[model samples]
Target chain A: MPIEDKQKPQRNDRVTIRTVATHAGVSVAAVSKVMRNAYGVSDALRAKVTDAIEALAYRPSRAARGLRGRSFTIGVLLIDIRNPFLPEVIAGVNEVLGPSHYQAMIGVSDARVQLETSLIESMIDYKMDGLILVAPRLPSEILAKFAVQIPIVAVGYHDASATAFDTVNADDQRGAEIAVEALLACGYRDIEMLSLGERQGHAVSVVRQREIGFRRAMQRGGLGSSPAIGKIPIASPKREEAMRKFLSRKDRPRAVFCWSDLDAITLLSLAMEMGVRVPEDLAVIGYDNSPTAALGLVNLASIDQSGRELGQVATRALISRIEGRTASEHIFQIPSLVSRNSLTRSGSGTDMKQG
Target chain B: MPIEDKQKPQRNDRVTIRTVATHAGVSVAAVSKVMRNAYGVSDALRAKVTDAIEALAYRPSRAARGLRGRSFTIGVLLIDIRNPFLPEVIAGVNEVLGPSHYQAMIGVSDARVQLETSLIESMIDYKMDGLILVAPRLPSEILAKFAVQIPIVAVGYHDASATAFDTVNADDQRGAEIAVEALLACGYRDIEMLSLGERQGHAVSVVRQREIGFRRAMQRGGLGSSPAIGKIPIASPKREEAMRKFLSRKDRPRAVFCWSDLDAITLLSLAMEMGVRVPEDLAVIGYDNSPTAALGLVNLASIDQSGRELGQVATRALISRIEGRTASEHIFQIPSLVSRNSLTRSGSGTDMKQG
Candidate 1:
């Protein structure tokens, strides 16, 4: 085959709106209106444009469309990709987006505020229709500032008071309370909370919210005036060291609630290494019922916030905002608990109904 | 703060090549030449442009740049994100690209070929500078066709004969041989391999390469020419069922080599449930010595193919290709074995130095 002839099928011949217009014997504006589904286009004109489009197999170039208007692509910003929970969120976002014309392009920020800001800026520059930021590290003020430029729906970020952008969360505070309640029901009075040791503390963070819930729940249960909460550093070696110290502590609590499954699972592993028995020595519960927690080997008790559902809700909110819904919606889903061997010897705790 | 005033800081004022030229007291063409690092530019001219760029703190708009030329962003296509090994590769790519001007945007194809093709097309339409496809499902001919339009570097894909693109991989066949050799050295005469069951088998897949290595190693060891290779379905329920059936088999092999740690770890979990002792009744080793493999609890021996290193090499290769290194290069890195409890009762196996 000749090179040109061979390449002809692969190379897309540009099918402009003007081509559709000419084929339909109508003005270019008419075809554009029909494509956009504008209010002005009549049914007859729409049918004609549709017929012409079908005959020519007109597929508009996203890049060209992006240059003018919406690109039909939603950019998802993940704070960290290493966490198993994040992939579930991505799956949820993809599920909602798969059927629609919109496609997702993911950017991992590695939890750096600077990189997160830049990725957001890049998405905006790309003329993406909207953005879904999963557990963004940026402050509410900074996020509010960015939200003005484009439609944004932040998942796992707790800022209901913010009027700029919408937020869809799993009620981290309530989730933490549920974890504590599960522990309390199991007759574990002495309990401590393990939380991430971030340099700068922000009230908008889910970690902070969980801490508040833990404190409140402890107070409500009359366990202690002020329950001790251990701070686990995010870096390696030190993270394991903190968990080991906690495991071997002389005055360690009878039970513990961890901020996330990422930390909880590690704690479980280290506990096993340290000759500590789960539920017997240290009753444990974690947040974000990740896949690893459900493993027969791990069998960890976890609070199920459903990251997938959060992603789905956030994507829907972003789309609605993109469609010009001005009123910001702060959607919160209730979380439940999944009982397993980590909490009790029976390896079955009270199963709460999923919300 | 007033919304309009708050947004002022973020709304980027476009800085064109003309602005840089005016500031540096040079022509726009000289600025473009300096930006591209073309041979005609003098040191003095480069210094002037650099000074102006520094003074203005000018960051080029990727979208506008993409419309005209390079986007300074590389798109990474992942077949699946759930796999733990994939994240290490991403980390390696980021480590290399972090110091450079290029940023990475990832698209997950979910192991669907149609989705993979469309994602690749979208990246091209977005005008990405290059692409790094990690274990892509696309065939060599299709990939070669795509390579004609952009620079491509494939990791975990075996196509050394292709002249259109570069491939960076760990010697998967040799890695499998090492696994079997380790098993043989432990005096395990009867051995089997568990491989992913794909609907349409492709010879270019990494799984096939590993299977070929397993067979060759078995034959070389004076074992039967035709070794029993079990097909484990990729999905859940069925995957676990197959492993359970194998574990319960009366004529089950004394030892087994799994295609991935994902499967091997699950097999370990199932064996524990079914009361099948590791290294006593059945010995097992897996590929991709992932973090999970290192856990003291699930200490399964595995082929140590550093995904991060593969990612780094692939990114470097891609950058080279993008920078006009046209001759297709195929790079191979040797993989080593990390012996653990699953391989033997003592949890010790011959350790080879990693390449």
Candidate 2:
């Protein structure tokens, strides 16, 4: 066979809408109207068309359906996939969409701003009914411009003032405050926070929000108004190097709170290798309460903010906006602390066996 | 706005292919021909259409494009998202597709057979150029049936005999043999393999292939012909419970090879809680040298398959099929062992600091 001929799309004999119309003894127009639930479709005609669709096992082409109207597909844009917390959110979204007529298609941006923009535009061009962006890198103005093209709900983005799109978040400020409060309750006066280092820090980002909360909580607890906040590089060798430096600091705080479990877990491992006993030498608390934190070998204290719950809420919000109830709802869920062996020897945390 | 009105799809004034044609002072067919790179298109006409598209920022509707020909989209189906190893595969796919016009959309089936079938059908209906299914649960015949409609490349599935689709895999049988040989070299005469407790055992599955290799290597080493292969449940409570039971067994082997890092890491945690020291009492080896396995706290010895490389090879094979290849291609990559503390104390493995 010629290569040019092979390049042509392969044709498959499938049950089309026309086949359903013929089986129902109705015009193609009537069948289309009934499938769309358009006005002026008689009850008898709808019943007949529905029965024909079922009997023929006809699946309407998503492409044609998208061109005419709704595709029943939801686009999910993820900034990164390595974070274990993101998968929990996806599971929650799947739980809600499993029985519905909708399906989710995910696009990973790898946290690149350019790729993120193109993906969002591609989803809009696909005629997807709605989109759920988790930890998107775009600014609020850019997101608002795109929101005009489709119904969008963002998770982990702390933009409550935006009127164009809905936002669902686990209160990062409160999460950080809880981490500090836990350390304070343990009688640790000198405490510092370890946060992510970004080239350009956006106020709307979760990292900044946690920083704000960390400062306020420390001031309220009678610590210095400007408590020490260490910056950890997000990538590999540098990230580990930063953690090691923190561990070797002669004036390292008595207790430390990490912005995320991704970093805190690594810090614990480095601490162990450096002969720094966990609670006895340096008390540590982290955020996100990831599955790894609960392991018997890595019992790091953490703040519990349910990623699944955030996903469920974002999906519901997006659905509402797609259904025409859009008033730009911004929802927040409180995060609590999950104490473990890293906090203290007899910390009142859940037993490792259950984890 | 009324509730019913809100349910209607919102209208957006997106630039269309027709707009590009108008801007280029050419017919829609001429612009479409240029976009598709169809034969008999003049270079002058193609250049004009391309320039017009750039100036107008016109993105062709994916739905309309799919209806006429290719959507320039590749669909990726993942069995589960929680597994850390899956992300590496996605990274590999994205790396290859980054500079090309093609984009990838992922669908998570959560290991459900029914959902996997529907997602594949949906991708076909969308007129996606090709598909990459990772550890799909469908039978070979069913996949072959779908293969006629679209190009498909399956990762982690061991179906080299199927003529309809391509497959990419890490040499699972050899991977298991390497693990056993490593154990033997460590002077461990007693050993066992922990396998997944699935409802149905398919010879094509990677799990069963590992079992075959495990038995062969053990027998070759003068061990019993029928070596003990304990089945570990795939889910949470049951999975942990099985590990605990194995840890408490009085006649447990001196060393064990787990089917995956997911189970091996959990087993290591259980051993720690049960006061059974690693390498000292229970040497463990796992597959899929996942990030967690390399962690200092985990330090699990595992087979290095390089999921990223598998994903890259699979994508290249799928693109070849889409472009014109007809013959089925089954590619394999040899896996090696990454010795760690879990295998033996002072083992000839990479140091924990580097990990």
Candidate 3:
């Protein structure tokens, strides 16, 4: 009949999981286990506990909740923002995570092993839940071994064995085969392919793979009668000069295939400066469907692998691993095709053929 | 003696700044103040503290080290990853911060206010030292007021106030003038321009300024008899339809000036679908030296703004402000010009005389 006195003071503003558990008539561990949605809880109990949580309007501190893992943040290691391929990959990763509560924080390593290592250490120091490394320069074995101890995924990498990491690629072998086949279809024999480096690494540089595929396709077609293979040193200004040597030879190949859009661009610039016409003086094909390839100045024929798809698949793999799904290593590949243009022949010189 | 004592037991494991401060007969604040190189510490005292710190090999904890407020991480909010301008800007930012121990983390808001707000909040949650917002859609009042509370630098923004933020922007007015004048030089009187929606409340959007400059330049060139303007509805798939309708008019313009490279792309697509040859039926020009504009399929003649320079300028301003420089609201009015392309002149019947 008598209402209790109403001047009850609040103890603390913070709402802990323990309080929610007590209010829900359950153990604190049960509340936390429910909060994390950890295994071994009945659906009925989880529903009851979550309802109570909603009623209390409980907001857990990220710091306290993050101690056992799951910072809800994904660290992205991008070596070069200027790579042009990265933006698509990043977009794919964002597409994968945007709807979820996870956030991405990107750090640029600029291709320096020391800087990449430092960036990784800093991300680890900050306790990011997972990481996505795009085109890292570190030794694959070292990276793979390090990845086992940490939740990580690799994107756009072709060489690393997947023992210690999850990876998503564009099927470099297939992509190269497609590019080379397109060039072969154009009836161009005696092709010269410009690689990032002959010694850049293994046959997986995507660059290296494309070159091997070209060579194999040429061999299959018996088009390598003259065999005029050349390589561009990585990050070298001599790339253009070396390209010039390939272009000016008295018996130059009738076709040129480049492993990168950047290489294709250099070839185009050289062609223009030397007064050589695209698809006429030489037919050129490039990889990476990079935005540069679409430019009117170059109009290079290139392989169109989806960098964004690669990023999305890698991110999904990392998140799945973080979610305690099947661990170990996983690889996902996306298909790509050839984009016809000024540098791609259509039987007639200087024409974009369409059926 | 020291070797024997060290072998027995080393007292150096816990040589934190706190211990060093006590040993140097100084307050913890004094040690921290010296570490930050802040004012109010005497030379002799700093020397004494430095000697003691070296002697103890004291390492300051990152959490406790920045009581005066510094996280050494810069948060950058970009418009969209699809836009090539941003990655170029980030490259410049990295150039400045690479050797300075400052790291940049990017979040793409994609020109959305709510998303931008969420991104800023996420950066804050991560304890970022400062922030850089590139072409945000939020009002200047909200951004300016918020900037005072936090160290924020605006890029590609033209707000003329120092209340809450410093601004870095290209000379868009000059850029528009160049775009129009180039068309005039190519013998075109009826030059139509496309623009994004010019929002009210703040003269922050460079699109608004560019539009104004385009109008003024057309007027100055005596093309006032029949001025042309087109606005593309955002999130609309019918952008080409709008451009096609404009192009198909009996009194169609001889030249089309695109506000951005993306708009130009839509116009080019529409032209192709409509069977209107570029530079023949209509001359096309775009702004922003986007890689898409350079593609052979889309060799759009357009204005070039140094995204790399804008990034460099913004980073320099932020670093200077962090170092206690009094300068604020620094304006960057970089030059703008058009790149010559296959689309500079109208081809046949649609070609108009330069009035």
Top lDDT: which candidate number? 2
Candidate 3 runs further than 4 Å off: A1-69, A198-204, A222-228, A233-238, A265-275, A291-300, A342-355, B1-69, B185-187, B197-203, B233-237, B265-281, B291-300, B323-330, B342-355
Clashing pairs in 2: none
TM-score of every candidate relative to the true structure: 0.90, 0.95, 0.79
How do the residues A1-355 of candidate 1 rate in per-residue lDDT, one tens digit apiece?
A: 1212222242434566767777788888888777666566677888888999999877665666676667789999999989999999999998898888789999999999888988998887787889999999998888888787788899988999989999999989999999999899899999999999999997899999999999999999997878888899999999999999898899999999999998998888887777777878899999999878877777788999888898888888888788778889999999998887788876233243444
What tens digits encode model 2's per-residue C-alpha lDDT throughout A1-355? 1112237665666899999999999999998898778899888999999999999998889998899789999999999999998999999899989998899999999999999999999898889999999999999999999998899999999999999999999999999999999999999998999999988997889999999999999999989879999999988989999999999999998999999999988888888777787888899999998999888888888999999999888888888889998688999999999988999887343233211
lDDT score of residue B88 within candidate 3 = 79
Pairwise DockQ winner, candidates 2 and 3: 2
User: Lowest lDDT 10-mer window, candidate 3 chain A?
Assistant: A1-10
Q: Rate residue B114 of model 2 by lDDT.
A: 94
| Alpha-carbon runs more than 4 Å astray in model 1 | A1-59, A347-355, B1-58, B347-355
Weakest 10 consecutive residues of candidate 1 chain B by summed lDDT: B1-10
Q: Every model's DockQ, to 2 decimals? A: 0.32, 0.46, 0.19
Docking class of 2: acceptable
Candidate 2 error regions (>4 Å): A1-6, A37-47, A347-355, B1-12, B41-43, B347-349, B352-355
lDDT of 3 by residue, B294-341 (tens): 543455677888788888888888776665554577686655664545
Q: After aligning candidate 2 to the native by TM-score, how far in Å is the CA of A207 from where it should be?
A: 0.7
* Between candidates 1 and 3, the TM-score winner: 1
